[model samples]
Target: MCEACSSATRGFLAAGDCEGLTSLVEEVEFTSHWSYEDDSNNDSTNASNDSVRNRSMVETRVPRYWSWHQQSGEGSFVPSPDLNGWMLTIDAQNLSVGYHYRLCLDVDGVGTMQGYGYTGVKAFVSPVKATDVDLPLPRARDAELQLSCPLGPSGASAFLATSCDTTLPATTRVTSLGEVRTASVPVLSAGSASACSVMLDTAHLPGGRHFTLCVGVAGSGASLGMIGLPALGDALVKVYVTPISAFTSPRGHGVVLLGQNEKLFITCSRCTGSSEVFISSGACFVGLASANSSFKSTPTFASLLLGSSSQWEAVLDTSAMPAGQAYRLCVDLDGHIDSTLGPGDSGQFVRISGVLAVSATGLAASRVTVPLQCSGCSTSTAAYLSSSCSVGPLDVISGPLRDAPVSMALDGMGGFTVTPGISGLELFRHYDLCVDLDGIGTVSESFFSGHSVFLSGLLQVLGFSTVFKAPAQPISLSCSGCIDTSKAYLGLSCGGAGGFAAALGATAKAAPTTVIRTSGTSELLSVDAALLDAGKHYVLCWQQYEQCGPGMV
Candidate 1:
């Protein structure tokens, strides 16, 4: 027998396996190192030096090996050789089911190798349980699902399934799958780990309906669990309407007037597909027709179908409505009332014939002019200025003359101007100036209603005198007929045959004359009539020295 065969047979006999002992000897061959690296120098010493370093490193390192065994009682096997010659062992009792693994070897002298046989075993994979799930409202148009499961040797994946039919199972409509990922760190003491989350875009789905959601692994589908969400309403779309203004009657131009029937033009933002548009005026509702529609009716009031454009025009009749009554315009969409677009008096009719503004004019004895502005007032409307706001026996100031009739001149643009000449008016005195619209209505609601405006600071002249006497006794006298009291003096004269003569000198007359001063251009004086002849015709006079025209007696 060959020397290698004899040695193998003897080893088998010693191990008590001599009955089936078979021996064979073959020389092992290895590829030359020159094929892996350049050895053009043919230097054996360099090769020997490299081998020595590698061998020393292999000897100092601790060896590790992977052992795989079959749990079906097929015996254990170390499929890979250890670089440091370490021994490997496998116990079948610790192996699990439904898992397969292979061994890898890193030999010191040889290259890396893989085991030819695979070990199949069973592993305990905790059932996938959905810890929590969150889905957005139907209007939000998005879906999200979260789940958790036991950390298995191979981590699990999750997916989201949605169905429009709430009665059907969600798994039937698998819309999206969770991304694959490795086993994550344990989140709880129960060894439960969070799986990959699932997300779905629901923007394309119709709103206002119920939907079902299911979370599960890729292979398990929705078997893990399922949830239901209530029906959601559609998202709100903002709506806005432009302001409406009255239109001119014959000219058909836009204007603002009170209690006048005129066409109204309106513009708005189109937010929905509804062709029927309704406009609300306070508690009243009116159907509006689009300007482009062919529907035609009486010019008093009519409606048009709104076309593709956002503009709408209609005729409003205010013959039956009172002046100063405000109107509100509101839009209704699919039974949804949108009041935000309509503010107070957005479509109010023109109740005022014209607006009035009063201002003072002139220097001393001042005068005032009132400007009445009207956009689309009737030609028959009459405007005038009045002292009182009452109706009967109106105290109206018509012209620049004080006694002239109160009247306003129309500027042909629904406006009027009235400049009243107020003479003999007391300075610094307030007089109410009001504008009355006779045919149309009172412009009292305007800002210029009966405003107390007048000019002041004018010079005035006045004179007065009083006499007091006791029968058969001395008579007392008082006089006020001077502009400057400092220059004023009381003069006395006794009746004489030729004429009355000065009874006292000017200096002596000042003693009896008590000058009383005032704020105006007049002065007062008091003197005792006893200073003159009693029971005699006497003349008393108040006079300013240089500025006096004549002394009054």
Candidate 2:
């Protein structure tokens, strides 16, 4: 093997220089060497001696010269004069593998520099090598163990061995030579050629025990001196059991209103050990719907385990209990009664009431009757009328007339009716009538209607002149057939010619006068005399839309 002087040695060489020719001679002689051999055969050896003697005579006569020298065969030397350093190269073909070598350099006046000595300087051919091992931490249900091993030049095979002892047999050994084992570990080239891995099925190993793993190689076992697998004392070989961590269904807590044949779902964290789930209502675990003398008979319900061990379902029939009543529910693990569910109310039952139909009598000139029908309501509950169902003051209908007293009445059954007077009510106006059996807090629905104005009798002018002089002041006119005093008005046309043409044409030419409204069957119209002309005959008429009373002139 070849070697070069380290930087520290080169620094010493560069700082120290030969002073004179004598120093140069010393340095050159220090780097040179000679070899001699003895010949045993006499006849041919004498001939070689004669040739050697002749060569010696020529060498002695010539002047001797000295310079930096290098050994022949398997090595070379290159000098860097500027750097005062030299490098040596050696052909390693003839060297044996796994052996260390040391090189020494002698410089005149600089002492000797050596490599691979007791100072930890050395190089070896074909050093033993291996890849990192990836052993898995044993688990309860794990079915297989996978790992990787080093591949060698000649290829390799691998195996997995298990032992119950804390420490397995020695992974490495020597033939009195402390070199590592030259075993070739198997390579899994189908996946990665450089990195070989192996998978071992561990189903045969018993659970809940400690085990050690030993990895070994074949093919190049003798070349690699020793093997050391990773520590396996911490490996656990037991079966895995999933634990029940928490509950998921029925939420944290609240009331669950279960109707007839309605299913209640219960969920929990997955667990494989136990498959049974149990449900109970009273103190002890009683059959679903078991009869109790103190309380009402509990309804028999059906339960089923759904999907995996995480969920269960129970359905309620509710046929034994009356509607509108409340019940409490409780739950627990199948056999673990001490482990109660989360805090707060576990469950409850609530019956809902509904309105079937709501009707009202036709809104008439005098009154309106609202009739309501509902389910799950008592005879004492009366219906109320309001614009909205929001809890607040209600606009309830009262007494006989539009301005009468306010009251409500219900029949013995769920039906009820309220007749409120419409005397003061505005005709042809829509009203939203909302009825609640138990007021806004309970059940209710809304109805709508518009008050209709009826012309019961013919429109008649009670007091008017067929012909009259224009009055100095407005005249008081009256009518008897108007629907109501508030909705009725009167008009007159005067200061025109006589005859039906004059009467019909006069109305078109004159603007009608409005009359003050009053609360009675008859309305009095006051005509403005200033709107009339003197010495003119006029025709008077009573009109509610196109229905006009017999024209008066």
Candidate 3:
């Protein structure tokens, strides 16, 4: 065998990192070499080579043998002749039984067992026990069976239980099998099995259920027996019966399951993630149409819940409402939910409930609008303003007239008329038609029951009279005399002694009086009463400047 080429030699030769030479074998006293030769004396070899032509070869009795092991001190010997480098046992042998971490093989000086050089080392991993085996049985029935004993390394017996099913418990037994001690299963009944599986009766499990097989081997001849898991596996058996009904909410839908005869209402204020619009009074329900089926229905109000993925649900009791007949289902995804219908849109009123069924064969459809009313007013007006014309005839003809007052007269003799009447003669008298002097002045008037007039330039509407065919001009009226009923003027007028005066119009002046003061701290001040008239409408305003605090009140 080659000195460094032999696997055994190389395995031991690489005691250190380098393979050229090393002294670790001498230090550790570990052998790292081996050799072999043809042994013709062996009965089996002699018989096989008996047909050799030469009688000397057939009768050869010379026994050739070679040996290789770590050599310390002494003289070095050359490799045996007629031998080629071959891997030989160095780290381990069948006779030797012990644990070793790192073992390398070197055959002569050429072969290597590991990456470096052959160490002639083969790994023998220890065996561990797997899960126990068990026979399947119905949850409600009594079960008993025999199991094989467990084993460990060195073929020793071990103690174990039949607790293969996670949902159940187990018991074990010990017995003696001739010279070797063995284990047997203890007697088990239905009561023991019931404790393992709660709520499971024999009636429920018509077929046997699956179970992991297990075994025990305590107090046996061997400490434990080795467990050899087979490649093939057996199919499991099961037995089942009718089951009870159950309820569960679908994931991520914000839903809940309810029992029979039960009712639920969901009020989600604003739509959340993935939701677009959120109206107040958003509500939803489920299974409202059918008693047995589950579902969510719409609320009666007009309020709607808006969102991209926003959703809600209502659970119902199975006992309360069953399947079949159509029920109420009203959904307002965008508008306010109201309780009733009225004359106009109230915004507050929305339909919360409506009929819903699988078939649309026979069903009535109706619609309703809610009533509207101002908060502080005594009488509410539901009338719709159809048409209004308030623009100077010149302005209407000259410009687009988009900014013209709707109720103001557009002609020089006309004023603003809010109500557009059917007749032309009636519209001219009631509304003073005139053109505005400039675009600065604003004239507002409303005729809910009369005709409208047009205007163009700067002018004023003096006043109207019940009997006169024409109104009085500013020069024809007397400011100092008693009030006259025969005529009314719509023009500019004087206020005091030398103030400017013009044609009298709808605007009225206050009666003049001298300035004076009252004696008491709290006195009633008379507002100009002349500014108000019997048949005309006006805006009256007053302000109170308090010099003191609550004490004054």
Best by lDDT: 2
Better of 1 and 3 by TM-score: 1
Q: What is the lDDT of residue 266 in candidate 3?
A: 30
lDDT per residue (tens digit) for residues 1-553 in model 3: 3434432343322212323333323222233444344444555656566634223422323434221222111112234432553433333222111111123433333434434433443222112222222222222223322222112222221212212221111123333233122233331222422211211213222221122222221222211111111111111211111111111233111121123322323333322222111111212222233232323222223222244222333333332321111222222333233322111111211111111111111111111011221111111111112122232222331122222322222223221112212222211011221122222222211111111121111111223322122222121111211111212222122111111222121146333222122322112222344333445432211111211000000
Model 2's number of clashes is 16
What's the C-alpha lDDT at position 19 in model 3?
32
lDDT string, candidate 2, 290-329, tens digits: 4542223233322446556555555544443432223333
Q: Score candidate 2 by lDDT.
A: 0.32
The digit string of per-residue lDDT tens for model 1 on 1-553 reads 1211211111111111112222322222233322233433656776666654433221233323222222321222233342332323433233222121222221211212322121121112122332221222221223333334333312222222232222333123233322211111211223334353333354343321223332221222211101111111111111121222222222221222433354555443332333122222232222222231112111222233366354555555443333322233333332223433222222322222233233222113322445555432344333333333333233443433233335567766555666555553433333444333443344323212323343333222243344444222222222222333322233442111111133233323323344455544434444554444444433333223221211333
The candidate that wins on TM-score is 1
The reply for model 3, stretches above 4 Å from the true place, is: 1-225, 228-356, 359-553
